[model samples]
Target: MDWLNYHHLLYFWVVAHEGSVSRASEVMHVTPATVSIQIRELEKALGVRLFRKAGRGLVLTEMGEAVYRYASEIFAMGRELIDMVRGRPLGQPLLFRVGIKDVMPKVVAYKLIEPTLNMPEQVRLVCREGDFSGLVADLAVHRLDVVLSDTPLDPNLKVRAFSHLLGESEVVILGERKLAQRLKENFPDSLDRAPWLLPTDNNVLRRSLDLWFADHNFHPVIRGEFEDSAMLKIAGKAGVGVFAVAAAIRSEVETMYGVELIGKIPSIKERFYAISAERKLKHPGVVAISEAARKRLQ
Candidate 1:
């Protein structure tokens, strides 16, 4: 059985955090040479160079950054354990990391994630936003507890992930007050040849909207395309064009962006999913989000 040398690991952790051997030596009350020797031994055991010289300062290598993350968690738990043994109240919050697909509506994401804050345990929520595939890649390696996306996991990605559909929302057309007022009476017919702000073709909502347009034979004048939902709504607020949002967040959109609903298309639904590496969700924060989002979206 191989045993890890926690003392050597401690030295490496301090050096990484302090960003220099000399500073770490001061923190540890040890000579710079002693700190250097301890870190070298740790690197030898781990078979990775944790730091590299950049100009006059030292920086962590790629592997070092990963190690530093683990070290941070390990030390945090160590302190918590000490507090537990002493019957002191634990101050550390449970860390819940989530990834959001860039195309996911910000209001929708906020609604879905809001429940985790009300959980019994103290939770520190961390959110990252990126493209779908990139977020899925983070989920595959366990960097993200779960990913919130408008679409389900693609089987072709070769990742072992399960997509739990939270719920679906009817699509709603929205525009600035005057534009919505002009179109409300005519509804679907009013949309024909109307200046339209749309999601780029790559988005699932865009594709669904395209299908709906074809089905109704409504030809909208495309004024602009956006990948960001917020930007699209901003343009709509300026009356640049009409836009679509999930009915689930219609009220929020109206309040936040000051846009009025032009019409609702129940036939066009926007679905949301919580994609996780686990076949069954086991994290408390994730479970809270999934349960609450399903109810909210429904």
Candidate 2:
């Protein structure tokens, strides 16, 4: 085996963990072809086929499975070494990268940690925004130090949950009319009568809406779908349709777009969690951010 092939092992590890070249590519921010070529090169250098086709996805071969077991440990140790080097008495501030669900209010989330960011031990805060699954995947890959999200995580992930509150709110939006009389007149008994702006099908909020409709024997007339709440709010304000907005965001919606809350619908209360890998709880940056989120968002 080529002694310099350790770099390739990192690539292999990502592919194995992600279960697909395309997914690994997205996580690594590389092309699928690049990931495939590197994996092939790693296999060639090691003189074995690491994976074989299993239905639509790749499954590890016997050799591949054994290699993966060791690869995980090797990469983990490598990360520890890197951390050790960075944590040395350099007297410099340590940068902590944190991810938050885009659905969350950034002002509230940041204010929670504002004090910690100015500690004597230089602490730099890096914030990223994404949906629940994307943030979790980034955390699993070690790309993000910690994540704050309103969605529950998979049991397989090793996470420390700091907040347990089930925050419930209705999915509502300001109707087209600002005047109370006009809004009251336009209110419909069933949402099916109005064109609705919904989040993508995969979103937890969207799923809750679907469940509510099923229970109530109503189907919304979906005018369009959006991935971002800000965009949906814009569409709602423009009278494109009634868009879903969390109660937490109602004030922003009202202030920004003059949207009037027409009615409340039955939707599941969202659960917000400040989660990090169980192993990373001891890391000062992770600990600080987690505590901050728990204090404010919980």
What does candidate 1's lDDT look like per residue over 1-298, in tens digits? 7778888988887787667899888867899999999999989998999999998779989999888777756754564455347532468787889999998888899999999999988889999999888787667545788999999998866455789999999999999999999989978889999999999998899999999889989998999999988899999999999999999999999998899989999898899999987777777878898889867895
TM per model? Answer: 0.70, 0.63
Pairs of colliding residues, candidate 2: 168-269, 174-260
Residue 169: error of model 2 in Å? Answer: 5.6
lDDT top scorer: 1
> How does candidate 2 fare on TM-score?
0.63
Clash totals for all candidate models: 0, 2
Off by over 4 Å in 2: 1-12, 18-58, 77-85, 88-91, 99-123, 127-141, 147-173, 176-192, 263-267, 273-280, 283-289, 295-298
lDDT of 1 at 255: 95
Candidate 1: residue 7 lDDT (0-100): 85
Give the alpha carbon lDDT tens digit for every residue of 146-210 in model 2. 77666666665432223323234545545556432344554545465567888887667788878
